[model samples]
Target: MKRRKAIRNIVLFSLGTGIIYSCKDKYEAIKQLHLKHLIIDTKQLDILDDLSRLIVPLQNIPELADHTALPFIMNMVEHVFEEKDRQAFMKGYQSWDQEILSIKGRAFSAMKIEEKQQLLSEVNEESLKASQELYTVFNTVKEKSIQYLTTSEYYQRKVNYYQMAPGKFKGDVLLVDLKNKNDE
Candidate 1:
């Protein structure tokens, strides 16, 4: 019995070390898995990169440019969206680029960082006046925000900043729906 327990402990320690090394830096692992796919048309992809980074500035964590989510997003959009919608996306992209270029005299990605932020602000204002049927600029911005926060290294670090929550729980109680709060 003593010999069996010693063997079991040795095996468990080996497995733990393997798991720890394997789990190291998920961001770096994902980046390696997705790097080759990142090489698409620079012109089309740059808009996404520039816009997403503007929405989630790089101060708190890694820059959006570091994670390559913008290229991944562009690939997904070009391949996955319906034909008509893809066409609209392309058109919307061109129109937005033109608008920003007129304001800053350069492509959105090439503009100074401050100018990019200012352009996004103006774009948001214009989106507010959009008619019901039109897809507002804010919708594009929102999608870009979703794309960045879900994939960027900054977001990943933020999410993993804390250790995992404890697993064991003592008890549970039924919860009440709060929808009737308005009636009160």
Candidate 2:
């Protein structure tokens, strides 16, 4: 009995170690893929930030840039977007930059605000008419930006929409007798 128990413990330990190493290997592989594919450069990040600000301009807020939305959008793009969607976004982004350069003979980052707006409008119209994938990318960025901004604590606080916990529970509200015709 002791020998059988010792053998069972050894087998369990070996299996557990094997499973742990396998999980570790998978984690490393995922990390490598993220590093190679999902990582964005500073310039690209700046471009995304500028594009987001253009898409969702803050009117009453004092902040010049989107503090919450941009980061959230970036995080979603990195972690939540599927492989095909990520590829589509990358392709669309590159094409957008090329279109801007071809049209204005300058980098998008260097363009004036009016020029940027005009370019964006033109591209938006073209994307809507020409390609569903391009349109999806554009709409995704805009929608995600709006979603993150609206859901942010800062925006909620600014709008005075934040409610305390256990919010507004009515325990003993009187119910009207809708079934009785005379009660009305």
Highest TM-score against the true fold, candidate: 2
Clashes of 1: 0
What is the Å distance of residue 62 in model 1 from its true position?
A: 3.6
* TM-scores of all predicted structures: 0.47, 0.58
**Per-residue alpha-carbon lDDT of model 1 for 76-177, expressed as tens digits?**
555666666555655665566665566457866677778767766765666423332124333554575577566655555454332257475436533343
Assess candidate 2 and give its TM-score to the true structure.
0.58
Evaluate model 1: give its TM-score.
0.47
Weakest 10 consecutive residues, lDDT, candidate 1? 18-27
Q: Can you tell me which runs of candidate 1 are displaced by over 4 Å?
A: 1-41, 58-60, 63-66, 101-110, 127-138, 151-184
